[model samples]
Target: MRIAITRRGYITELDGVNKFIFNLAEGLNQLGCEVHIISHALGGSQVSNIASYAEKFFDFQGKFQIHALPFSYTNDALALPLWFLNGSRLINKLEVDAVIINGIVPLNSRKVKIAVNHGIFTGSFLNTNRITQHIYLQFAKHIYLYGIDLTVCVSSKLKEELGKLLNIKSIVIPLPLKLNLYRTEPLGKRSPLVLHVGGRSSKNAEISIQSMKILNEKYDLDVKLIIVGHKNAYLESLSAKYKYMVPKTLEFYFDASSLVVRDLMANAKALILPSRYEAFSYVVLEALASGLPVVVSSAIPSELVKDGFNGFRLLQYDPNLYAKRIKALLTDDDMWDGMSKNALKTARKYSHIKVAKLYLHAIQDIMRMKLNS
Candidate 1:
């Protein structure tokens, strides 16, 4: 079977969506399917030149062919239409059995197309812009109902949201991570350290920081809050007032190629995610694979985390309770050990090979259904 995957983003970026595409493409190839990647050129002053774009393509080493579509406009709304035009032309030239679109975009084609829903627009609680939110919600609904033959959601929470919008249930497929790249290490004794992974604007980061402040004041505990990602001036200013609480360390965004994240996860006392919304978080999964306990918001699906077993779920943004959970995980050795073991066990189910088989099964079913129709 020949499959064509289309994405409207830079392939070299280490974001969750790009990571998903790279891993899925490699997995499909291993399953004996001829795969091709159709991507739009990232047009900025830095990479606007043809030679820069070609270099980016050469950086992506895969068993499949890559076709870069010419797009002059950088705005997604304008670029998407141009992408569809260029992609349609390429599809006519290649005999592909199916096309997998990574996001919601208007594409009128006869081939079987699948739309993967990472998160519904309505699920973003922190976004204050009403007009942009409405536009995104409308687009999601249109793509879910009319633009694609099948839709896949990364988490049950997101699946429920998609079902409500489309009036049809979406297939739930958890995001897969390369577990082999992250090994479970025995960090004998953990310090009073709370690790938060993501950008500053992330709701998860916000909740984690607030919770740490509560924990520090109540217990008078000396803890360090290490945030890995870009620093937001807004968050940084907020952190300044609570100088006596927990010491904050901001590490800017770095390449994922280094095993630094794995090392950090293995050594941390606990991973805390105060995200207001998420389809499925790669950081949480990576932390689990490293045998680290997690304290996440209740908004995240229970299937991905258990309240008392592998991780603690914060029902709402209560800084005091969130702090208490983190403190317990840090001080209580027996409870921490149990959660760590469970975390590793749960993470094994999301291995790359296992996820690859599930994706292949879905594609096969779609093909069979199309043939019968």
Candidate 2:
């Protein structure tokens, strides 16, 4: 089968969506499918040759073709309409069996078009004014279901919201993880280091820092926190500001390579994710695969992290609660060991190979239905 995947610029970035596309393509390729990446042309090295750039940054060693759109735009808003037009033209000409669009690009295609909803943008914008949120939701709903055969939501939370708010039906398929890339070190060998994967607003980075402050200062625990994500000016400033209070307890790694993140997960004692809203977190899954217990918010799907099993699931984004959990994982060796073992076991179920097969099944089922109709 021939498959085409679409995404906007910055394909080489080590973000969640980009990584998922690469991993899924690799998995499909291993399963003997011809995978083609349909993407827009962005600046920098990725514009010239995305395959080489992905290989260098994401360590993507897969067999696939990279088809770039002619024009490049730094602003996604300015680029999207053209992306839909050109992306549709490219996919229609290629005549692939299935077209997997990362987000709602509204590409005009007759193939089995699948739009993967990472999360509800309006849901994330709840903190904003009501008028703004309503406008965003209306605009999102209009474009989200256009010319798409199926909507793939990464978590049940997202799927439930899609059905409830936009009345769009979607399937629940969690993101894929490359299990082999993460090494599960023994709990005894790991340091008292806590890893937080995202620095975005929904990630609740401010609360993470506050919790780290409570851990290092209030509890006087000898632990360190590492925040990893793409470069954000706000996060850079926040890190600098928190240095005075938390001192050596917090560190930020902006635009770190995939290898560096894997290494950190391997050695960290626990992963803290106090998200305000989450569709699905690849970081939480990756941390579990690394044999690291996680302390996540209730916003995270229950399927991924079971409270007191693989990790603690807090109902609120309270710093005191997060600090309490981090303290236990860092100081209580026995509790940490048990949860760490369970974390590894939990990760086995969501391997990239299994996820790829699920995606393949979805694509095949949709195509079969189309043929019958």
Candidate 3:
């Protein structure tokens, strides 16, 4: 079947959502489906000032075609409307079989439009602006829920929220991870290194840093925390103050092509994610696939990680408890080995081939419903 994927997120950066879109398109194409990915002309906030527009646009590669929609203004109000117009025009011109829109696209295309919900912007208990969160929820309702024929959520938690707001059920389809890209090798017992990966603005990073400090002071563990992503001034300041307690490393944003992340995850003893909220984290899946145990917040969906099995899930924002779990995993070799094995097993369930087939089936089901209606 011919399919079109639409996204407003940065294609230039190697963020979770972008990785999902790229991998989905590639997998679908390999399955003998005609796929086209339509993205916005602009990049993300972090790279907007540093990278050129052309540099941002040229970062993605796929088996199918990619169309970039140009916008006159950078503001959300202006950009959203323009993106809708441009995207609708492109869909009409292509005349594809179906369209999958990431986040929300205010387009009135005749083709079946599937809206993918990554997460709830408002319900997030993270350190985010209340006004901005409210505005985002309102926009999701107005643009996303009202504009799509079907909806898909990356996690059951997100699906529940969408069902409540839209008064319609959303299909739960976990994000796909390329398992072949990350393989397990006998890295042996890892060093005193804990890895945290993702954007710096996420409240999870703050929680992770705090947990590290607690672990350092309480257990006197000489562990090093390596945070890989765009560095924030606030995070940098925190790291500087706690430098004596824990050695920290801040790496700049890199694309998916960068091998540095794989090396970091493969060598780390554990991956700690104390996110206040998350739909699904591809990084955690990647770490697990690489034979690294994960420690996540309870707010993260249980399906993503099983506590005391593949990984440990802590109560929301409990830095001391999170630290204790980390210390135990770091200190106990037998426990760490068992958890690492379980993590690899869990990662297999999210294999790229399996996820690709699920997405294809969902799209076909949506199309069948449209036909019957």
Candidate 4:
């Protein structure tokens, strides 16, 4: 079947949604579906300063072709006029069986559009600054349900919120994974290293550091913490302070590649994610696939990790609690081995091949329904 998947903009500027779009397109292509990915001409954010975009680098490796049209820059004045003129013209011409939009957005397209909502990021912007968030929301609310045929939510948490925002029901689909790429040889003996997967506000990096500090001072645990991704001055100061207290106990990797993440996870004792809020985390799933037990918030979707089985799930940001959980795995070899084995089993369910087939079925089902009506 010929399928067209639409995304907001350029993939060079990375985020959770961009990565998901590429992975889905690749998975669909591998399954022998003719897939086409259409993206906006002008992309990026005003705050992040990712204003520049290129037509290339977001490669599908001969599986599909990327099409660029001026359907984005949603927060700007030119977006509506461009949509009514250029964007609408481009989308109406696509000769595809189904069109799936990658986010909870509406395009001025004639084709039956399926929207997949990733998160309430626009709503979350209020926590930082209200004025800019208010301005962005004004534009976003207009196109949320326009031309949408079906809506897909990635997690239960997101699905519930989408109902409140759009006042519409949506189907829930867990994030897909290319599990085979990350499968590696098990470590004979893992180092006492706990890996931190994110550095953003929602990632709760501050509390992660606090937890490690408690482990060091209170429990006298000689465990090393590996932080992967972005870090600000506050995180840097904390890391420096922790190192002064306990040398070589903390390490930070800035903007690491997939290979670096794999290498880190392979040797690490556990994957620690203390995110305050989330829709779904690909890192948590990937860590489990790499055979590392996770220490994360209970707020994280239960399907991703089961408490005490594949990882520890607790609500408290209490450093002592996190430290105690990490200590158990470090001190007990058998317990660690069992949890590691279970983690792999949990990850196996999210294999990309299975998810791609589901996508095919879902689109076909929706198309069939639309025709019947």
Clashing pairs in 1: 204-274, 204-275
- As a TM-score, model 2 comes out at 0.91
Off by over 4 Å in 1: 43-64, 122-139, 187-192, 214-217, 231-258
Assess each prediction's global lDDT (C-alpha) against the native. Answer: 0.72, 0.83, 0.73, 0.71
Model 2 CA lDDT for position 309:
97
- Give one digit per residue, the lDDT tens place, for model 3 in 1-373: 8899887755554566777876677678778888887875454553343233222422223466757677633566677777777879999899988888885768868887888878765233234587866676677777655677778898887788777865657788778776776756553645577888765456467667777777767788877777766556856766666566453432223232335677777778888888766777877888898999889987678887889998898876777888889888988888988988998888888866677798788778878887898
Q: Mind giving the per-residue lDDT tens digits that candidate 1 earns over 1-373?
A: 8888887666544466766776677667777888887776555653445333323422223477777777653677787677667777787578787788886666657777888877765333235487876676676677777777888888888888777765766888778766776766554755566778776455556667777767766777767777676456745654565555443432333333336667778778888888877778877888898899999888668888999999898887777778889888877888989999999999988876677678778877887898898
Candidate 3 wrongly placed segments (more than 4 Å): 43-61, 122-139, 142-146, 187-189, 214-217, 243-258
Clashing pairs in 4: none
Model 2 gets an lDDT of 0.83
- Predicted structure 3: clash tally: 0
Q: Model 2 Cα displacement at 106 (Å)?
A: 2.4
Give the range of the ten consecutive residues with the poorest summed lDDT in model 4: 50-59
* lDDT (Cα, tens digit) per residue for candidate 2, span 3-102: 9998765566566788889888888888999999977656666567777777655667889988878877565566778877888899889889998888
Could you give candidate 4's per-residue lDDT for residues 270-347 as a string of tens digits? 878888777888889888889998899976888777888988998887777787888887778788889999999988
What is the C-alpha local distance difference test score of candidate 3? 0.73
